[model samples]
Target chain A: MSLESGLNQNKYLNLSSSWRYLTVENFDKITDEELVKLILENQENFLFLVRRYEEKLTRYIRRISGLDKEDIEDLLQDIFIKVYQNLNDFDTSLKFSSWIYRIAHNHAISNFRKSKARPVTVSMDEETEIARRIASGIDVLKEVDQKLKKKVVIDVLKKMDKNYKEVLILKFLEEKDYNEISDILQKPVGTIGTLINRAKKQFKKIVEKEKIDF
Target chain B: MSDLSKNVLEEIKEHHITPKPKWEFLVRDYVIWAMFGILVLIGSIAFSALIFMITNHDWDIYRNLGQSFWQFLLLSLPYFWIVLVIAFSIFAWYDLKKTRAGYRYTFTKIGLANIGLSILLGTAFFYSGIGMKIENIFADNMPFYRVIHPGRGITVWENPDKGLLVGEVTGFIDDEGFNLRDLKNQDWIVSALNSVWPREVKSNIGMIVRIIGKQTGKDTFQAIEVRPWMVNCDRNGAPAVQPCRSLDRERKPFIPFPLIPMPAK
Candidate 1:
């Protein structure tokens, strides 16, 4: 299996077609925390964590920031570097994935603020999928063609306030639960709930303004 | 390893970057938590002062002050320390929120923690007498504090023009009244022929009492009601409040050190 297809398939744990420092059987048993311990014990093991998170974080950054692939890679490099530097500071209480995601989230937000950029959907399929998932929360996107639905959702998302837009993407596209969203955003869970509610309202208003049912 | 991972490892080597010493992170975590604890303790001290002031305030003398109970209470509360309790709780909440896992707790959770700890430690401090000691220290050292807090007991008594006088009985005057040295050390003839003793107040030398009535002359105050200065009393006039400090509070030195000396009767 090629790396491109692995990413397209959204197989987060598929280490196939990649360099294997640890055997597949051993890697399956070892968790992210255990990987962190191994990384701390020997800095060389940090590569496993880097490889493991590379695609997932790349997609997340590109999805939230709408940065170019090269820019996303550059951001990913910096993020992993930061993760390596701060391994000692990682709280064991949090899932290691959440911790890394939080770091990535904060860095992306900081980067986006410094350079004013709008979030976007990179691919047509991802756009339609996001619109379909988002539509379930509001109203069903009835007989509208898949192409029109994607365009409408993408336009509404682009027009929404950056905060609401980011939250909606995290909830619908990234599939993070409320608690996970709170951790990533470093907001109170209650605040996240309020943000999501307002985001949905804003989304519905934009959809209505567009006035294309389904 | 992926190329980006290789580059990161290479950068790590070039920069000699290491996972910062575990002690550094540990110390950081401890410092944030220590800061939070210190803020809560300071808030508790403010709470203790609040407790001391509210407890020692003459609650039943609102009628003498010519105001309703709530009016007197509203006017007499220690707003300064109450503001401090709120301010320190926010500071404590912010400090706690700075910790790694701190954001997990909402401000309400942290605020409740701060107030609960403050109430617990504050009541303890009040009972341990630190609260009263703090009140006294502020009362004596910071005269400017007098303008801000002015104090309930002292201010209530300071309004002698409104027919209130707090002082020691210096001498007797033929059953018509007594020679009194007021809080300011001024002399006054307190005429108490038909004065009501409302609460275990005795007209004796060196007994600190609060008198209410009219100022009969420049150097005299006609007493309508006499009450003990410090101790709150039930109908029987026994010591009826907890953390009362001293059963002899009325006779002991108050507001300042060592009882004022008057010529023995």
Candidate 2:
């Protein structure tokens, strides 16, 4: 089917690839680089690309922004629109995921600042994983109560500076490496390591100050 | 399909949002690099001017200035231009950070790179005479700049009591003396009778002549020796009649400046 007709077909989350030259592999199997190339050839292929990142980006935005579901969804809509408009600006040298995450991080931060939403909380589902991840980095003994660790992690994250918290979240929760975090934040890799170290130190300071016995 | 993704696609079709043209991003990237390069060029010009000022200064006159050699050297260094070179290098280094992969380089690395390029290009500028041209432009156009940027001749010729006076011969006051305006804009009556005048130097209306004689009065000077206003005099308060080591060095008490020649009037 022609791409224009597919747009009229109301397929949003599950967009089918209609490019004549692309192999009939499932869209999930195609690298983001190839997908970007296809999208450049035909704008209709953007929907399939968007479907790949929609849920992940939504979760990322929610983790950082603490905005309500509706606000997060609305912000996602704008963010995707921006992505579509700047597809040509995407540098192929960067992993598409890192570039997209960078865009999402910047947009979320600016909107968070403008709306005056000082959101220091991650969403509910990410809480347990975040606690476990941060605790491992800080060497909090496995014997420590999981519930107590979660409380300490959340409280410490909330009190830390936005810069430190953002690096920590990207490093521990998102599982981004130093280079990926550097690309996403537009900082040197060396600086990323320093920031992560400083963030961990801040976490230790907060837990110590509160006398949390983890 | 989730509703949010559906809405985004619907809006994409409704508003027809297309990826911006590749040329636009390319232009933006090139503009950033171009700005970085231009800033470095300007910084080099400032550095070259600094090089010219420092190297062209007559370090030989320290004894006449009644200061130690180190004190004279330190006092004559061009502090204003030094600050400008530093400021421009910083601006250029910051501009480089805006480039696509500029962040990969450390501050010390990038800073040293910018400074190194500036020095290399600045030394070239010093030779091509662009440095002196820029200095003269500032000297002629900006009165305030000229005040802070004392003429090179002013230092060597300021101590009239030490038999040093330099200025433009404004007009002749008959064969015995002439009207003069020194580099500091001070007026003087220059007496050339019983003074030594070089063969090539004429009593021109606007010639910048140097007089090595005692200051006889507040606005009068006796010329023991009169030579062209030159910048590269050697340490004994001597002037080089020409950069080529003029054939007249055999003349008694004659000293020669080297490496630079005064621009012919």
Candidate 3:
């Protein structure tokens, strides 16, 4: 078959109702790398990959940027488009999830710059969980109730430098390990460790500056 | 698929923006490394020029400039080359930070590394005589260099208080003195009674020599040291006889002085 006819046949096979229950490799069992290879062969299959990431990435963009629904939608489209265009450059050794998050982080940071927004805060539920996580890590904040601690942490994060604040968000809100944070920030794991420690110190200092009786 | 996914996929289909070619990144990396290499080369040249100027300066000949040792150094030091070294080092620091793995190091670390590397390579270049050749090129080409470098030029020896004089030996008066014609062709009796000659120099008639001593008479000088008046020679071993106006030529003060008759004679 000519290349166009072959592509059309693949499209036909993909759209047929039999594809949902087909004997081919299952979507759940296939690795993201394998999915990427399949997508390269037929661009229409990229929708499956996009659907997998859309909800998680949408929430991630919202939490990191605090942009409105429309802006988040626009950024989500841009990030996915960027992911598609640069799919060839992805390193197979890294987890594809980390690479996607890295792209998202970069795009959101750029959006923040464009909008001239300084504050990146988590939702209340996320803040409460992150505050609990911080309390578990640092003993001093452990005594406070989850709500009060979350409020204090949010206040402190709002006032901190972007470098420190981002590490805190990645560590507590996103619950990412040092290596994943390193990949996202393009820094060494040791630097991520240092940044987290420094961020904790700055968090405490900001808490003190605000005269919070923690 | 969700509407968001469908819309994004449709946009990708319409725009068809592909990843940049791998060669573009390779080209970028090559250009960055090339820039770094050029900076290092320029920095090496600047640093070696600095080392050459320092080592080749006549530290022992301060009396010829009518100044104390420190004063002569302050006046004649090659500040231009030193400034060039600093500028190149800064450029190296800025350029190096843009390289892969360069941002991992602190700015001070990068700056110090640049200086340390330059100095190490500069030492090698110094030993290889690239530094000396570069300094010589500047000294020979830039006439104004003597104005900034005080210890250069025959004018330094003209100060009677400095106990330095350049003259051609017209005839030996005796074991203690000689009738000499200064560069300006003025006749003077040079008293070499207590003069020291580190090397045995043939005091042939018509030979030019520099006498470092004090003036004790209207037409006489008391010599403390006597040395041959060396003219700079070119790569072909031929004398590069600079015109009298050229003040920045670098020459050893101890080479054999050729027997050239005084111009006025």
Candidate 1, B144-209: lDDT as tens digits: 666666554564686788888887767777767777887668989888889886424453455566
* Least accurate 10 contiguous residues by lDDT in model 2 chain A: A11-20
> List-wise, what DockQ does each model earn?
0.41, 0.49, 0.32
lDDT of 1 by residue, A62-130 (tens): 778777778888888889888988998888887788789999988887777777764554455468777
Docking class of 1: acceptable
Query: Which regions of candidate 3 are displaced past 4 Å?
Result: A1-60, A87-102, A142-149, A176-183, A186-194, B59-77, B132-160, B164-265
- The per-residue C-alpha lDDT of model 2 at residue B68 equals 99
In the range A1-214, model 2's lDDT, one tens digit per residue, is 5444675553332324643344333567677887887777666677777889988888888888777789989998999899989999998889999999999999998887898878767876677788778767765435565555566667777888888888878988889998899999998898888998888888778887888876
* Best-matching candidate per lDDT: 2
The better candidate by DockQ, 1 or 3, is: 1
Angstrom error at residue A110, model 3: 2.8
lDDT tens digits by residue: candidate 2, B1-265: 5687678878987887788999999999999989988989999999988987887666666776688999987878787789889999999999999898888778988999999999999989877766777776665555555556656645567678887777776788777878888756789998888788764344456656667778899888888777765433222334432231121221112113323564565
User: Which candidate tops TM-score?
Assistant: 1
Best by DockQ: 2
